[model samples]
Target: MNPLALSIAVGDYDRTRPLASGAVRIDGVDPLMIFLTPEEIFFRAFRSQDFDVCELSLSSYCVKMANGDSPYVGMPAFLSRAFRHNGLYVRTDRIKTPQDLKGKKVGVPEYQITANVWARAMLEEDYGVKPSDIRWVRGGVSQPGRPERVAVSLPADIHIEDAPEGTTISSLLAAGEIDGFMAQKVPALGPGGHPHVGRLFADPAETAKDYFSRTGLFPIMHLLGVRRTLVDKHPWLPTALLKAFTAAKELAVGALTETGTNKATLPFIEQSLEQARALMGNDFWPYGVDANRKTLDAFLHHHHAQGLSKRRLSVDELFHPSTYETFKS
Candidate 1:
């Protein structure tokens, strides 16, 4: 009856900080939490199954899940979530709107990354721009010669071109080689740099707000994944993970609400939170299977439609059975 020790790798987010610092602990488990960049975590996780527990790209998970090649089963912790409207960058000279992207070459660090899938969903569902509508240019965002962390076999209709030998997508977009680019991590192009390089949506916040009002989806980017071997051996592990991450998030959120001193060093924390609560309600960033079913389903449809997943993966198939429900007191 010894506490099982595990190595967990994830982002250095406020919600996950408690787990690393031991402010929150998983039931009957000892965790060695390693906060890492999403890129590094995923690159290692998919390639070598690096960590016992890790944050994973939802798109890549589905791609592997549908192919029946995944080594991990997902936990609905959803450590990372974002609108992704801001992920897009475009040249003002050529692209006027999302519609303008049709038949144009757009750059993506990886076509199957979660953010790009959500961005593509926004373009296709809201405006009628399918994934096949634009010729996709695949490359690095900041550096050169980066490839997809997990190779995906896209359908015939969807096309991708490797970025020229030594060029990064940021440079290509700046040079007008690609009409638009999905800049995952912001490239160093701002005031006094590449005058024409700008965001596709001038005010992406408002655009995202409008999108949420219509779609009810605040897109999920990453999920906690447990190695399937571990899950099969320790049947209680997934729910223990769920309980720990949920508590960590609540603690982090409580700090934001404390008016005496700010836990996060940002201006107008109170007012900003008020606006967020008004839009998405108290439990805005919710966890678990039942809560995020719509968002999950939408992502599954997008993943399948865009040819990333061979078939649409159901929410049931994505996680362990114990995680799908929790014991009620």
Candidate 2:
């Protein structure tokens, strides 16, 4: 039989680039790749189930999974992962620390996005600042009128309001209308940028590194997902996807480790690679549930606590059964 024909929608990241360029191929699959921004891929996928295989927001997926509304089953291939300590922006004159955020109005693109979830969780977990500690302002970080991708019913104590009509959080932040801003992407305060725009953490990299040392959570943002109906029809597909995506990430890792020539354009490629390995081990950006159980467990608990999920989801329920166990060599 001909290989399964499918459309794979994901970002053009180095790890996924191999699959998109055909250097990596899923077993018994013929995939048409569509590279897109995270917002685009998630908006279309969650709204319409637009692709056979897609990158899904981890928090949103858990929300759907808990509600039994998800049309997709997760794969262990985390398409995006990052330490979100650097994602929080604040006013230089005020909000010097996470605790200072209490009672302050902070802007977020969405309350349920993985980056915000991790940042908020980190703030509470490490700094003892709860989500209810701060009033939330939801709006577009850079643009105007971006709504929550997935609807959420947060606890009564958690207060959130939309940005004013025709105005972005960035503008509110620049003009000191909002005390802080939080999102994965950088906020454009204005053409030259505002003098007051700054990060809550004075040294985010050091703080993130310290957090990683304390808690081995790198914080996964996105994971690969296939439609549940398709997975039901092709039981072998989840494992096939996991294998190919792992292979693709391995190739990207190899390129990063090759110090003879810089695979990435950054100046400290070799130092950065060594530092990452030192901090998180050789398999720093690991795939598979077993390897990432701690990370997933923390995220799930935070997801439930923050009211993103209907209930706390276990790590076992996050991925399909086929992805849970692989053949032993």
Which is the leading candidate under TM-score? Answer: 2
Worst 10 residues of 1 by lDDT: 182-191
What do the candidate models score in CA lDDT, each in turn? 0.90, 0.91
Q: lDDT tens digits, residues 136-234, model 2?
A: 998897889999988889999999999999888888898899899989988876577778888888888999999999988899999999999999899
lDDT digits (tens) for residues 89-174 of candidate 1:
88899999999999999999898999999999899989899888999999888888998888788889987899999998888888
Per-model tally of clashing residue pairs: 0, 0
The TM-score between candidate 2 and the true structure equals: 0.98
In lDDT terms, how accurate is model 2? Answer: 0.91
**Residue pairs in clash, model 1:** none
- TM-score of each model, in listed order: 0.97, 0.98
The count of backbone overlaps in candidate 2 is 0
